[model samples]
Target chain A: MTEPILSLRQVNKSFGPAHVLKDVDFNAYPGEVMALVGDNGAGKSTLTKCIGGIHPIDSGSYEFDGRPVRVHEPRDASALGIEIVYQDLALCDNLDIVQNMFLGREERSGMVLDRASMEERALQTLAGLSVRTVTSVRQRVASLSGGQRQTVAIARAVLWNSKVVILDEPTAALGVAQTKQVLDLVRRLADAGLAVILISHNMNDVLSVADRISALYLGRMAAEVRRADIDHTRIVELITTGRSGDLGLAPEQTGETGDPDATPAAGGSDPAGEADAIRPGDAIGPVVEPAGPAETPTATDTDDEVPA
Target chain B: MTSVTPEAPQLDGPAEKPAVGGPRRSPADELKGHLQAYTARVRGGDMGSLPAALGLVVLCAVFGTLRPAFLTAGNFANLFTQGAVITTIAMGLIFVLLLGEIDLSAGFASGVAGAVLAVTLTKHGWPLPVALAATIVTGVVIGLVLGTLVARVGIPSFVVTLGGFLAFQGVVLIIIGQGGNIPITNETVLAIQNNNLSPALGWVLFALVAAGYAATRVLVARSRRRKGLDTEPLVVSAVKVAGVVAITAAAVAVLNEERSRNVMVVSLKGVPIVVPVIVVLLALGTFVLGYTRYGLHIYAVGGNAEAARRAGIKVARIRTSVFVICSTMAAVAGIFAASRANSVDPNAGGSNTLLYAVGAAVIGGTSLFGGRGRIVDAVVGGAVVAVIDNGMGLLGYSSGVKFVVTGLVLVVAAGVDALSRRRAAASGA
Candidate 1:
């Protein structure tokens, strides 16, 4: 495999006394989609922010393009061709699509904005991404649909010739068609030789677009493996219990066998609709209860538990 | 059973409708679509200047009926001059408003500035230019102090400016020497209020301004079309140009009418110098807000500061710069105010002046919520406030009547703003 274009080793970050990320290791290669998945409050945002330079890691070694680098600010990340499309999209509602796209880095001639050239470039970029939902680039962001705004954001990231693109929940609020469109766009981004890090809560989206899956549990890297080697049940096990038989942290470090509720009691039960009826808040209790035993995964176990 | 799909419906009645499901649209159908879209926007609380335009028309009709002379050119020239200072101050207030910030000190800041100008000239024996610069600089310093306290120290602008409002009012009184009024005798400063150009020169200036505006509109449209970009149709552009020409012609014709030949043969009275000064300021303000990068950032910061910061904009710097702009413009407005009154005193740039300026900006359709207003709002709003004041005085109404009527106009204007927003949200849902 080609060397990773971006890699983080032993990255640790904390907010005062709360250590949000601990000894975390992550990497993404060229032309690959690396899916970063975790439950709520599993350090997904902290880890992504570290990579985007919005938060400086307390201790870590970051390697970009096979060389050690320091990213102390967001501009440094941008300088290194790293872009993050935040969950809220970070778009100005009052400005039009073209204006929002070229906002901070407006194209100008002398002192005045070169609207003609900027408009042309915006149109071409949209076309390149096969975005047809918007009838006009001059339409204000406030008037755009959710799907169109997402498209504009994705296009903005890629337009800068970025090498690494991180998307935070790209389809969290989207309809089925929008999800499909964004997933397809994600694949095309990887196909264009850029490393893509997709952070998502949707299992189907990760399964569909991720070349590899990495899971975070309790501020620790629970499992990282090829998409072909892991199934939905094993991924769920890694998420809930920080282990799946031999795939994740060993039993000795967890101080338990990880078998208390690993049988997938809710997996094969009722119809899909019945399972879907399980409210998010209610489901968290059963899934998180088993995770209590795996909270203190030892460093030695994490080292030895890599999938063979 | 050999059931077959029904044949596609033939293209008839309403070619744009789904019966045929074709992309082709007739001009009438396109016009219908445009009208529907426009109505939807209005319903959604994006009324633009519709309410302001209507308010102006209603005021004119009522006032003209009460006194036939109210429609005369002399009264309009007087109204324009009266509105100048408030309009100038309101223009600056729009900058602060666009950032979702308020500058309560704007009225008294200008008052202080006018006092400084008066003292520097009468007591210090300074040149007119020196006095003007010194007064303007004082305004900048006051703005800088307020902006820093608000932006860097993180004090709420409402609190900071409110403090400044009272502090500056006291400062103005001190500068004018404890209840003393300083009469301004400088010809250049006094001319802004009293002087007028010849009738021919007025027509020439109006023609030049009108032509320039129409040319810009046409040129921009042509360039956009040439670049294969979207632009308004030629007929629409022509109609807009025609509207400008008509308004300019009417104003010039009315201002040139003979007011009185017995006392003084004052036929062909032209617009006051203050009118042109306001126009120049408006043009500059519009250019900054609409055509510049800094202006774009102001809107973005006002709309969503978090998003703006994430996008790498210097949100603090933008916020600070706007306060400075507002204060500097307030100083200029004070000069106009002093000119109109022909003197500087403790009364200059008091709370009343600030109230009028705020009223004008709000009446002009600039949203109190920010990120949704225009420079033109101050123009229309200033005119509305001035007309109210002027018409009431002409009718020999008491100050009480003036206050009630003006208060009602402001409430109605604010009601229109709030109601349209609520209705838009409901319809959008």
Candidate 2:
């Protein structure tokens, strides 16, 4: 792969006796969505906190644009063209959308706020992101729905020449349509050559959007699986059991797995809800009909995830 | 049946039910919510017309009621003389409040400055303008020291300013130097308070102020509308402009009052040059607090210090400069007050100057809580306080009663302000 826009290498962090991150090796190349998937205690928050400069790594090197760099604070991170769209969004409820967007960074003309120009620019920013639900840019943020707030936050990150965007569960609480909107935004962001780091727990969402999946198991790097090689059974195994080795609870039908349960004949993702429309190569989970029993994957399948 | 993912939340209806009904309905729930929201907009500092309209009413009523003598052009001119010094002091203090700090020492600092200037010019045989410049410079020095202490030393402003209050009063005592009061008999200095501009010039100046204020208010309201902001009705704006014109005309009439045709006519002669200084200072204060980058930072710091710091604002510098401005303005006021009185005593700025200045700001509708208020708050507030004092003095009230009345006014104004805020907060505006 071409040199990553940023890389986190062998990062270690500890809070007293609790080791939060252990020898983490992570990288994001330009125009790629790198998904980090882990259970609650798998150190996702700690890793991102380190990246966002909320917490400094106890030891390790962070490389950005081919050089080892230190980001000790949010300001430093921003100065390096790294932006994080925090879950809480950090917007003032009392202010209108445009005003909240430019709270401290107001555009000025001579002595005045040059408010007209700022409003026009804010409108353009919103429109550029395809945000259209709200009727007025001057409407107070308090009156906006959750999805709109999320869009605003994401738009703010990308508006300021940001090269690396980290979104923490961007669709965690959004409705299905809103989630669809956000997913579209993520794809567009990466398509425009910006590296996007997506942190999520929803397997369906990870499978749908991520170009590659990196799993962290109890503060250690568990595995990294590129999209083409992924199968649902392997992903579920990695997520639930932290291993793809079959536990021997069921039959071994390992070799070539294909998703036949959902065919494009079922309403597809294009306009229609086609379960079958997922990529032809995607491996559906081993079918366990109520009449049938549980199954396990063989030893060989576990090592298949390591990209060549 | 296809089992759908619970992703499509009941999307359409969260907007429908909240048509803003009153929890305690006064029969018109929708209208009530709209009205409450309007009031909230004003209290939140999102709009300026409310204060302007209310201030105009208060100015008219007070001048009309207290002294039938108040409407004459001569008395109206005298009103400017009364308002001049306080306006300057208040203008400066607004800067301090913008940075969410306070200067408790200004009243005393101004007293000391006034005393020094009067004594130096009259008793020590100094030229008026030279003495004024020197006095203003000393005030600036005092401002710098106090600002540095509060800004650099990390001392709470309350303690620093309280110290200034005490230390400066002592300086005032030294300057007076065993004298109860030193008279300023210099012609130029005395004329600052007593003299008037030509009538045509005075009326023209009044017209200019009225026109400038009206024009600015209209342009601003229009700009807010152009940005798709909620704006007051044009009729409301027109009424506001008319009220300003009427008040200026009435003031001219008050200054033209003849309490005595028998002796030298007790008429307000001309616009006190001090009036223009006060007006210019106030306009500058308003502009800096509302229009400039420094103003936005000040409000940001006041609204939330952590947020301001996180936004990379230099909070310490803003805080220090606020104190400096407050004290320096007080010094300017001292110059005017001492000149007007034709003397300065060690005790000139004592007892009620600070209290009244603060009270005037409160009454004029500047919020004590930092994020809210306007420069005009101080101006209106000063006028209210001045009216009370001047009217009471003319009506033969004793100083004791004056103290009681001033105290009462302060309490009432503060209580009303607090009540309105609580009401707004509860109403979800």
Best by DockQ: 1
Q: What is the DockQ of each candidate?
A: 0.19, 0.11
TM-score of 1: 0.87
Question: Model 1, range B292-337, lDDT digits (tens) per residue?
Answer: 8888889888877888888879999988888898999999988888
lDDT of 1: 0.78
- Runs of candidate 2 with Cα error greater than 4 angstroms are A1-4, A12-21, A28-46, A49-61, A65-76, A85-99, A132-155, A167-308, B1-75, B123-129, B210-246, B253-267, B394-396, B419-429
Residues A112-142 of candidate 1: C-alpha lDDT, one tens digit per residue: 7778777877877776655555667877677
TM-score of each model, in listed order: 0.87, 0.73
- Quick one: best TM-score, which candidate? 1
* lDDT for model 2: 0.68
Docking class of 2: incorrect
Here the TM-score of candidate 2's chain B is: 0.81
Ten consecutive residues with minimal summed lDDT in candidate 2 chain B? B13-22
